[model samples]
Target: MCRWMAWLGQPVLIEELLFNTQHGIVDQSLHSRMGAEPTNGDGFGLGWYGSGEGPGLYHSVAPAWGDANLRELAGHIESPLFMAHVRAAIGSAVQPTNCHPFRHENWLFVHNGYIGGLHAVRRDLMLAIEPGLFADVQGSTDTEVVFHVALTFGLREDPIGALERTVGLIEAVAEQHGIPDAVQGTFGVSDGSTLWAVRYATQGPARTLFASSDADAIKRLHPDNPRFARLSAEDRLIVSEPFSDLPGLWHEIPQSSAVTVRHGGVLEHQAFTPRVPVSAAHA
Candidate 1:
């Protein structure tokens, strides 16, 4: 598994979260608290949206903690919306293409769990992807497959629905192979403005996910906390774990739920149950 974070709001230096937090993503690369593994040193990636460009990405097969380029870039670059992920390969090749925050156009996607028995279902799932997207599949990882699956079902038009269908299709195929609990992940996707975070699994238990509280509320609670005061109510963050141990600043996303963060900072969570029920028959 892996650890990741998504930022949507003011264009602040990436260091603010990559290094400045009490337990930042860089730190998590070596000591993650809730990931399936503590050290996600296989690879890492960062994606951000600039003023006019759709999105820019930086990926490396280096351990995030030892990557000097990451530190230098984080200190210099800034974006209103950005995504960072630390990877721990789940039976996939450890390479740059497999590094996360996978991008297409302005959209960026990342995952924090695995698709069980991916090796068994890989061929079937890959064939189901649209021919155009299949041609663009550069990586050999379940995470990339999930991204293309969503795109195959129309992620650009309706992210939530497309993702739902993608997961359903995965479950359907996995069940046919007698693989139980085939899907397990906390996923995040953003199109520069709005962000959608999902916590779901074929089994009942899913990975941990959290979202920050209203920036305005945090400001009122800690008027002197310069960091809180600097952010507007619209600034929002979704993460695999809290960046800081700020009490009451982060809320755990309920299991099987999807959270949407819109432009201007409004955040909402909705309960999400997969349309195709997990068949315990194969379990």
Candidate 2:
């Protein structure tokens, strides 16, 4: 349904990752090999960490492959952390507000999934959001709602737990509505520092998720490839698909799992289990 990529580690011009790679986001926008649709041209967004308290955002209701503004800004911006996405609208309209990398304070979130029967349960889920956060709902996509739900459940203090609750709430609500296939997708979240991702689905196999192998691992895999050699050990990429065909350079995150990229490629992996937060049941 969408394509996204995240970068953490050495500071580099955004274009290097967004435009320069052989099968980068731009390429994915036009010819994604793994998304539900090959083309994710509905809209696009960028969220990057620079010299600011929170990440920067740029969204457009244009196809990512042809967005000149994105190319221009990417050519100039250098960030230590970056989250970029090219969307393929599911049940929502193709609009800027519905773009990925939805932000809340210092956090940014992107997802490639849907809440089954969202139109039916949207009202119930909206009631579940904390009042303070409820006002921030500006888009009608299930993705935006998921981001806010995570925030309502404590994204700042506990991302994994918050997402667990977020998914749990979605599943519970889906059950209430008799929608057996509750959720399916991978979620990426960042707080201007570490990058985290969850690969999950309620009733089937989760969507694809890949993280760059350790710098050393990549070097060993492609011993003489300078492109792999130049990157710092800290530089890591988490993407929907590997940007290139280099074998062993990308590790597929397992189903029902969570990964954290931090401290220079010291990837942390954990089994993800979702349970409804107390509020989900009542709301």
Query: Highest TM-score: which candidate?
Result: 2
Question: lDDT by residue for model 2 over 60-109, one digit each (tens)?
Answer: 99999899999999999999999999999987988889998999988999
Off by over 4 Å in 2: none
> TM-scores of all models?
0.95, 0.98
Q: Which predicted model would earn the best lDDT?
A: 2
lDDT of model 1 at position 188: 93
What TM-score would you give candidate 2 relative to the actual structure? 0.98
Q: Report the lDDT of model 2 for residue 192.
A: 89
In candidate 1, which residue ranges exceed 4 Å CA deviation?
276-283
In order, what lDDT does every prediction score? Answer: 0.88, 0.91
* Residue 136 local lDDT, model 1: 77
lDDT digits (tens) for residues 1-283 of candidate 1: 8999999988899999999988989999999998889999999999999877788999999999999999999999988899999999878889999999899888999999988888899887887788888877898889899999888877899887778878887888898899998899898999988999999988868999999888877887788887787888679999998888768788999988899998788888887765542232232
